[model samples]
Target: MFDCIDWVNLPTFFSMLVARSTIAPVLAAATETEPEAESSVVLAGVLLSLVAIYFASKIGGEICARINLPPVLGDLVGGVVVGISALNLLVFPDSGALGSDSLIMSILQSTSSLTPEALQVTFEAQSEVISVLSELGVVILLFEIGLESELSELIKYGPQAAIVAVVGVVLPFTLGTMGLIAFFGVATIPAIFAGAALTATSIGITAKVLAEIGRLSSKEGQIIIGAAVLDDVLGIIILAVVASLVKTGEIEVMNIIYLTISAGAFLVGTIVLGRLLGPYFVALVKELKTRGPLLISALIFAFLLSYVAAAIQLEAILGAFAAGLVLGETEIQEELEKQVIPISDMLVPIFFVVVGARTDLAVLDPTVPSNRAGLAIAAFLIVVAIVGKVVTGFTVFGQPDIKRLGIGVGMIPRGEVGLVFAGVGAASGVLSDSLQAAVIVMVILTTFIAPPWLRIVFNDSDRLETVQEE
Candidate 1:
């Protein structure tokens, strides 16, 4: 077509042509933005989930505090309140609709009656982000624990901590494995995995309890912290071996031996090497002009160690914990803690709520045949989990003021580590659904009971100390 163009507007016409050519493709891609838009809804759901968890935790914590209980109990209970098992409060959408239009969804919008598939879909969709947040929260929490911890104290009590860790790991692993085999009649791999679940004591929970009671710096608290850290190292080693067995269907003795040595080496090596180098790194960062460079630098260090630990097949938290230990020894320890505490407070509750959300009482019902079987197995495992850890407290030698019972109870909460073990097993098809549910039951009991019980023991110890002084 021959075009008539005004001389002054010629540039405008060409510009419009260029704009039309480029803008058409851009507008075409706008159709594809629907997927991205859909993702925004999912993001909103995640944010809402967080908000629900936060308020639930706050309310739960307040109620707990009113009754002289640990606030974490409330955080966990709040998780249950919003979780699929109880209130069905926070469900994500599988379709782009966010499930608002679905009759079932609408009916249960303010109540707790969600379809299993919908809940699961939502959970899996948001699982990755929530998992990362939960993990980072615990890492910060552990780092704080490390800051409050002294290396010399960790070393002085190292032998006793080692003994307590060994006892704690062995008893739970043995009892859990045997009980799964004998009582639940599960496969060897699942039984081993179940045992593995019981082996880790959530240092986050134990440390928080001790810190709240002002015992975190006490001799016994130090021992418990040391032992819990060591217990995690050992638990991961066991998990690695069991996972390999599941994959290869054959146990590799040398592989297990190598993993054990490597894990130990990595932990000790990090401590020794970090002790030599951490101060220099901190000193280098101290000259930075940024307002929060020190805190960021510490976080970078923690994250690097976490990545290293993961690369070597250990838990990332181990690396974070190691980073804290190293940084805690530096002169900037006080400043780091002051800066990090607010971050820890904000993120830690999310981790606890996630732990609680994983609990499903529906799986433990006595009315269903399979659930009854799971319930029975769960009951047995709970007893084994409790008594085994309690006995390990007595294994600590010669610290009469140690509050051995408190230490044992401190070891009780299986927390996230247990869930991780169970999850791996379930994913690998090693743990049947019911078996996983049973493990979840055992974890919840331990997680719920320990905080208050530990507080009670600590109070009793305080009273006894006062009486003796009088």
Candidate 2:
């Protein structure tokens, strides 16, 4: 009978009659009853994963040094072993495509589920945040690379550097691209992906080798590093064009022509314009009275280049790399480096760990359905990747140079670039999931294995060159 009381007067009646509001206490009590441990547990796990990745990279990098591998290679493999696919993927199963009890698949699934769908969505959202963090990590990485570049040495060995870089990038790109067509019968999109992967020369390993032998400042060392930078710029542009074409399914003759002409032309234009404009821009910074302008200018140019590259259907990394080159040629280069280095030191390792965390360590078992194709492709691509670069080393325009070959071998590993391709290809659907796995494996192998192989090749070639001179 009391339920018939009028509700319409509740607001006015409460205001008139009540000395204090009851709503606040009721809301606080409800919140207090909710389980806060769930949120804490998830955050704690993410933090621990990040910490594990950090030490793994550092320890793995040291191991690489002892074994004569490029730390980049180690970082790449290390990341694959513990990445999103390996660690985080265990919690996810391609939307329940795999059985729950699969031994390898249960690693990430052990966390107690409060609710199935809610938990899955949370995991996916976490992955997305980590991916975004990786992007920021990349920016810091470039800053570090920019800092490592010694302009004085680059200028001294400029021609040799350009020559080596040119042959090194072009040959592997062509060979790898063609291999997709020849051996795999893969279409243009896939071929382009294979080619783009080859365009990168993992400098982390090369830089380490140079540092060890006291040649990091020598004629050979300077040229190799400089060219690797150029190769990165060009590779990124190619990646953009290829990705665009793949997405559009329109590989017209004009598209090919456009990609070819614009690639070199853009590089040339960027260099000429950047050099001519850099000094003036630095003067602007000087006039502005802001000591941080160099950093600002570098960042602006990097973004502008990224914008321009995307507008032309190229990747932003290409623009970032080009910006680094432009900055390398300026007096503010040193200043920019000083400003950016510490930031890189702190942030770049995070990017590397994030990268490691994203790598899906799950190999395509032959027993698994549709995995044989993936494994076969992975193996084929690995050989094509290695042989392609090694052969490119032998393509010198001058004398029979084993030293050049060794340098080319040293430049073979793909590192982040390959991952970018596999990721983009998979996301774009040009690469099937299995195909993506294959590509990732191929990328990991090339990145992890090439450094020590190159070291051996470099040593052998050094002896051969010495004998030839005698």
Candidate 3:
């Protein structure tokens, strides 16, 4: 039945109809029409991009789930399929104008030349909307994670967690910096930037994997979670230091110290202070007659913390996480989770898909000399990143019966944090395109490998008994 339809001619038929019916009338009426027409075009583009993202992510995720793989992996692949690199079916337009003669406008009149800035304005507007939604999605995700966590767990495992985090950061940073320097002959600053990108474990990916495998409450989960949080704090400080180095060409010890203090204070102070003030805020909100007041108030708190974190030169997600820590201790913890999960389910996919879309797989092709270099560096970094993180699991020696391999594997995924680091470096010109691509490859490989390894390590009853007996 589908073969009866002429797919190739369908687009031409629609184009002719649109040109004859819509574009012709719009152009003819332009002299009498208000400015709203142009705004509508931009709104249409933004809406279209969002619709594409949703369907692409949904289909991709479903496919991956059917294969017993992480759906997030599929979401990334889906974005790549429609992104500028491949199908180019989706348009995240550049900062150029949409002239009447442009591709979009030309659909109606192939030769008609209209206003110069029309398409550019619309594209910019669409881009801004997508950007805001992406940020909000990640912010909410961190906040939700914080809600599920207890501060006491972090406190109890503080020593081992610190060792895990410190070793995790140090080894990867060293290997990444040295490996890139040796392999690519890159400058110290660029090498450092690459190393910094490798240091942070993406707590989000690790936690999700643990949750999926039903080990989120296990002892290894506690250690891995605690270390990942600390690693995030360290990552923030490292990012600031790298940014400063790129801008000033000199590393400022005082600035690094200040950033460290600020990030530490935000985490410690927010949790402690939020815990103290949480009940009163909850009590005040309990008086509201509105539906889902607890959730609304909780989100407001999260957004506030996220804002503060951004203002203080930290990632908004950190503030969001802090908000979760505070809110998790409140009387309404379970209610908050109930409200937030559905929202997270919708938004988190957006963040992951956008991240995937940003990745251009073409850059990893070894046929191109620069890209070949990047691929080589990426290969080196992947090995270093895995081994460096795996070693941290041994740092858990003090804790008996803990699955060291599981903890190590749990800390392996670099995920979003690594991307954030590479993005910053790339934006600053410290990381050349190839180096940035390499970092991305490292991030992708680490993220892809860690989860399955974790599942295997966790499910090995024989290994578990051997370790327990030993």
Candidate 4:
């Protein structure tokens, strides 16, 4: 065998073995690095998404500010422009958009070695991250609103606010439900679901506008804010009941009672307990000598309460609001408010923009044969949506000087809350395509119109007040 082997080939054979050994480790290291590379791609996608969000927010807000409209509206418009409805830049999987549909995903694919399967996974993860950020943005917004609010004034107007909230729910639910049933010939369940959609009042949007106009501390503003809080509670209960009905074809009475009681108990308990512990909270913050002790401690308190709220089937924003109300009574309240502003400036716009982004304006196209019926139903819902909440202003008694119209107009935009209802109905398969489209149309118009309309009403009211004073 030794004689058969060529002496000249020995060195080459030995080199081939060495090359195989070296290549194995290289391949193994690359296989190990694959997951890490995927992670990098995911992070890159998120960074790009944030970039798009910030750009849209600033551009839209600036344009709106220049036009004498609410900058929040501009943020929303910016979101719409970049969203699936227009640019397909910031689409989400919840909207039935594929990874391949996003321009951002395409860029990632071209510049990197992301496979189709991995791209889908990354798209979902990235969307989820952005969505959570959006949710946090709103929670922070509501917390800021609570900080700016007067607890005593809110309590003073509590009864009136309760009445407003109740009337807002009952009137819209009754009229919207009955109108769909009688006028649109929609079935009972679907009509009820659609009616439920009409009852939502976007506190975040209304609060932002009011705060912008320096009306956040006004008597009317207090009433609107108070009512909006109660309305949110009621909306939760109603949504649960309706969703239950959709799934099981029957209402869960016991579940409804539990939700109502729990909601009431949680709100009252948080306020009472937080007030009692307010001084201690201040003292604790004073003891801490850290970079952001005050802000960090406050956010921790807010997040704890928020977690509790979510655990109990209530909205996390409610807990955050309660936490703000509690902390607002502390000595550090003013300083804390100052610290929170910058954070709010960074985060709050994300909420408004994401809301606008999620809204599919395509539903409003009457040129589509299928959308014709929806347009008609949408018209009816819009009329009810406006009138139902507008009349609630008149329901306020004992405050004759309060801006009743402003209060009503403040509640007009259904915003993200209305979209929740439409989404649930669509998911349940209870809503017809036309009916779902109709609900979406109503949401879009009400959301787009309310900010500007509220500004005009309040500005006019202010002018009238000046004239009367003169």
Residue pairs of candidate 3 with colliding backbone atoms: 98-119, 98-120
Candidate 3 accuracy as TM-score: 0.84
Against the hidden true structure, what lDDT does model 4 obtain?
0.92
**Cα lDDT tens digits for candidate 3, 1-470:** 89897898999988888879977777778866433335566566556667778888999889977877667777777877766557554434331223332233333223333244444455456666776787898888888878887777767888888999999999999888887778779999999999999898988878877877777667788889889988998998888888888899888899888888898888889988998898899889979999888888888899999999999888888899889888888888888898999999888777777766666677778888889878888888888999999999998866776888888999999987888887788778788878888898998788778876787888795566879999
Prediction 3 global C-alpha lDDT: 0.79
Runs off by more than 4 Å, candidate 3: 1-38, 89-116, 461-470
Estimated TM-score for each candidate: 0.85, 0.68, 0.84, 0.92
- Estimate, for each residue in 1-470, the C-alpha lDDT of model 1 and write its tens digit: 34675878889999999999999999989864433223543465567667777898899999999999988889888888776567665432321224443232344334554454454444445555666788888988888888888888898999999999999999988988987888667888788888888888888988988888888888888889999988898887788888889999887888778778877888899899998997688778978997789999999989998898888778888888888888889899999899998998889998888777656667867888888777877888889889988888899887865778888888899888787787788778888877777888998889899999999998998899899999
Q: Which residue ranges in model 1 land beyond 4 Å of their true spot?
A: 1-39, 91-125
- For residues 1-470, could you state the per-residue lDDT of candidate 4 as single tens digits? 69987789999988998999999999999887564336788889989988999999999999999988999999999999999899988999999998999999999999988888778888988888889999999999989999999899999999999999999999999999999999879999999999999999999999999999999999989999999999999999999999999989999999999999989999999999989889888888889987999999999999999999999999999999998888887888899999999999988888888888898888888789999999999999999999999999999999878889999999999999998999899888999999999999999999999999999999999899899999
Top-down lDDT ranking: 4, 1, 3, 2
Best by lDDT: 4
Which pairs of residues have clashing backbones in candidate 1?
none
Q: What's the lDDT for all of these models?
A: 0.81, 0.63, 0.79, 0.92
Instruction: Sort the candidates on TM-score, descending order.
Output: 4, 1, 3, 2
Better of 1 and 2 by lDDT: 1
User: Where is model 1 poorest over a 10-residue stretch in terms of lDDT?
Assistant: 90-99
